[model samples]
Target: MTPKRVLVAYGTKHGATAGIAEQIGTSLREDGLDAVVLPADDVDDVRDYDAVVLGGALYAGHWSRKAKRCAERNADSLKHRPVYLFSSGPLDSSAEQQDVPPVPAVAQQMERLGAREHATFGGSVTAQTPGLMARVLVRSGKAGDFRNPERIQSWAHHISAELATLP
Candidate 1:
């Protein structure tokens, strides 16, 4: 029996969302699935994978353009597969504390694709993050890396378990 192929694609600014996608891919692989992680811009098609986990970084309460465009471009194919959506943002612990519903755009995408679940993960912003706003936030002590590895792994494992039950 062949292992199921899963694609973990992300749209990120300053690489935080990519890191989350990589974590999801690793967890999926550990569960004995064939998972590949890629940048959203590079994913031209979803026809090759049995399932997909698509994620984006949030900016001003909006999903990244790259991520949104990827979903729009592959809407037809994605709708036919098991799909999960995620957003990486909230420089604070809000995401870990409670369910942060998807932004309006992401919600629309989730409905359009019939996604099984959506997770909102904490984001990162530090002095090293290039941007005047990031620097300002860092100076104000309002930015930090809030991504919880345990939560990410747990969600990925949940997806893995769900996929196991699928054809």
Candidate 2:
């Protein structure tokens, strides 16, 4: 049998989310799946892959515009495949501690698209990397690096395992 092909598409602002997507792809590949990581804007179609993992950075309680558009544009194709959604933004120490909510529009879209799973991961912030306003937020202790690599890898492995069982 041909290896299952998975697309890990993401939207990022400061690149933290992109890094997470790449890690997810790597973990999937290690689990004997074929995975490709790309920015949401770059992925023109989802029909070529057997499964898809869409993720984005959250800002002001919203998913990145590119990710939202990707979901909307490819809703039909995505609904027919094994689809997963993830949001990477919450400067909390743990995923459980995050008070952030999913973007309402995106949530509705995911439901309509028959997404298999959805997850929220911790995010990171750095005073040196962000702009002036973001720097202030980081300095004020409102933001900090809270991403957990182990958790990300574990999630990817789970997805790989699930895909392997698909007919």
Candidate 3:
């Protein structure tokens, strides 16, 4: 019996989304699956994995361009596999209030690729970041660390359970 291979691919600007992807990969591995975490741009083939979890940081209500392109380029292979999409953005505790909405174009692309699930998770913003805009956003009280590790773990657990039931 071979362990299921899962790919957790992500796109990040300040590394927040990458951290989330690593956590997901860790959780999946703990659940008895083989998981690899990689940058979305680094993955050129989805045919090597049994399942995929694609995520990206959302900026201005849009997923990272790299993630969008990854999906578009691998749509054909991804459609035949179990794929999940996640967006990490919004420095608010309330998921509903976050600016994590999937870009319309990206959402349509994911749908065409047959993604099974999509989730929006809270993100982090730091005041010491190099970008002036990021620093300003943090100083203006619109950004802070709102990531919920427990929630991320729970979602990963759910995915693990679902994968376990797959034929």
Candidate 4:
């Protein structure tokens, strides 16, 4: 059988979410799946694919608007196939609380578009580029890079296996 076609689309502000999406696409390809990574705003259609992975960056307890738009726009087509949603957020290292808020409305909407799984991953925060108030928050030790490559890799493996097994 031909490899399953998967669309891995994402939104990012600092580029971290984009990196995560690329990693997932790479893993899927390594598993012999036909995966394409594109910015959420750039993906025109989902009807041609067998599976779709929608991702976004979380800010102030909300998923990126662009990601939500992509999913919403393709909802009808996506619902006919397997769908997954992911978020890159949280500056907390401890998985116990992760200092992350619940999945935002935008992400929830994406899941409504036939998502089979939704995963939230820790992300990075930069002090040098922060605004005045954000810089103060960072200087006060309230910010840090909480991203764990191992955790990301594990999720990628799971998705890769699932996509590879699709007929």
Instruction: Report the number of the highest-lDDT candidate.
Output: 1
lDDT of 3: 0.87
Better of 1 and 4 by TM-score: 1
Each candidate structure's TM-score, on Cα atoms with residue i matched to residue i, is 0.99, 0.93, 0.93, 0.86
All models: lDDT?
0.96, 0.87, 0.87, 0.79
Q: Which of the two candidates, 2 or 4, achieves a greater TM-score against the reference?
A: 2
Greater lDDT among 1 and 3 belongs to 1
Over the stretch 1-167, how does candidate 2's per-residue lDDT look in tens digits?
A: 78999999998978989989999999999998999999999988999999999999988788888888888888889999999999988777658565445678668867988988788889878875567757878779787777889989999999988988889
Question: Candidate 1: global Cα-lDDT?
Answer: 0.96
Task: List CA RMSD, all candidates.
Answer: 0.5, 1.7, 1.9, 2.5
Q: After TM-score superposition, what is the CA distance of residue 8 in candidate 2 from its true location, in Å?
A: 0.2
lDDT of 1 by residue, 1-167 (tens): 99999999999989999999999999999999999999999999999999999999999999999999999999999999999999999999999989999999999999999999899999999878999989999999999999999999999999999999998
TM-score of 2: 0.93
Q: Among these predicted structures, which one has the highest TM-score?
A: 1
What would the per-residue lDDT of candidate 4 be over residues 45-101, giving only the tens digit for each residue?
988888998889888778988888898888888888988888887767553244344
In terms of lDDT, which candidate is stronger, 1 or 2?
A: 1
Instruction: Encode model 3's per-residue lDDT on 136-158: one tens digit a residue.
Output: 88779897877788888889999
The Cα error of candidate 1 at residue 32, in Å, is 0.4
